[model samples]
Target: MEGDSKVVESKPHLGIPEAVFVEDVAKYLKEQGSCTCEEALKKLEENYQKYKLMEVNLLQKKQRLKQQIPDLKSSLDIVKHMKSIEGTDTTMTTNFFLSGALHAKAKIPPTKEVCLWLGANVMLSYSIEEALGVLNKNYTTAISHLDSVNKDLEYLRDQFTTTEVMLARLYNWNVKQRRAAKATTNGSD
Candidate 1:
């Protein structure tokens, strides 16, 4: 039924296996000695699924990091701008977006401290210098994380290609073996 849902057992996340060469599939089958082609195919299919799932997760993470890095840079820029204007008697004026297509004009009075939202319904006041330091640190960390994610995505793509090639080679080997057996049986008859 399309509406039916099954409860699945939760297991700890499994690490992805190292990619195997296409020729290695034959060695693996020979080592098994009695593993049917069907069995080997099933195992390879499962491994492929694991790699696909991990790749999907990494892509989602990359998308989030791409969006977050820009916002972080923007926040850092605003804080830096404020610091540059410090010690001057000029009030800061800017347009704040209230919602889609609506803007509100705001004038920020000169002050020694600025309030920063720290997420989860909490905000804290900090000196302009302190705010700059915090924003810069956050920006750097996000960039580093994005770089790591990109590297992982590259590795995953390689694994995907390797698994597909292995599957094809194993299937071809199985078909040739079946044909050879059939020919021998017919000749004996």
Candidate 2:
């Protein structure tokens, strides 16, 4: 037996078969795909938060502008009334409130002209109509700016919705791939 040559069969080392390869490839793809999808979702969530914060800020800004408009309109009405009263009386006496409070009051002489604040601590003497014109212009500008903010908010909302849909689709695809890979492995085994 030692001198004679013995015929021995050697095993073939085929790296992997077709079925196993399919299952492994599917599993690897699912894992990698899901990881990428999760990262994307996280980034999308960050963007969503930023967008929501920006939306809130925009709303607040618009609200401030709207509030200013109403107050300005009230001031304009008061100025119109004052202009009418100024021409009628040569010397007018009115109660002045101390500390700008209604409770504390004192008598004071009112003149014909009134000083109006333009902007940034800038003041100028103007007739009633001129003051009214300035206030009206400011009101219109605020209104237009608010409209622009509304449009921007709408665009941001659309983008947020799109990202949400994309995230959902990616999640669904990941789940389906995982299930398919599991089924392939189980069937092969």
Candidate 3:
């Protein structure tokens, strides 16, 4: 029996030299004696090559996504700036028209046509002022609402961070308890 075992051990085998530290796996495969070592090595090499290719692909995707983040942020900033400028221009134009009409109304003599023009200008200015006041109030309200939303989001983010840390601690404790229980069960067996 000892001589036969020696003969078996002397034969070259798949996964033996490469995995010398893994005694249990080596013993199991040696018992099977199914495939040559060269075949297993080739398969492992192919798998490693495929894994490397997948890693490269994932790294490329990560780099591309990182590049996009700054560009998207800049675009968002540009859009916000443009909207602010547009709002200011609109307000200036409205103010200019109102001031010009007021100046003309004051200087012009009150002939029938001039009185009619003055009346129209005054009515239009009043309507514009009313509309502007409503819009200003609405803009203030919108800003307050956006501030509330940002505060809520910040609170939620902090809560989520705390919960994540708590979850990690719980998971570690659970793993320790499970391992202790398994060890106790195995000792009894």
Among all candidates shown, the one with the greatest lDDT: 1
Window of ten residues with lowest summed lDDT in model 1: 5-14
Residue-pair clashes per prediction, in order, are 0, 0, 1
Model 1, 1-189: lDDT tens digits are 433432121211234566677566557877888888889889889999989889889889989989988988888887787887788887889888889999999988677788887779999999988988888888899898888888778777888898899888889888988899999999999
In order, candidate lDDTs are 0.81, 0.63, 0.42
Ranking by TM-score: 1, 2, 3
**In model 1, what lDDT does residue 103 have?**
100
Q: Could you tell me the TM-score of candidate 2?
A: 0.61
Candidate 2 deviant stretches above 4 angstroms: 1-35, 90-112, 117-125
By lDDT: ranked, best first: 1, 2, 3
Which is the better candidate, 1 or 2, if ranked by TM-score? Answer: 1
Per-prediction CA RMSD (Å): 9.0, 21.7, 24.6
Q: Ten residues in a row with the worst lDDT in model 3? A: 109-118
**Which regions in candidate 1 have their CA more than 4 angstroms from the true location?**
1-15, 22-24, 32-34
| Top TM-score hit | 1
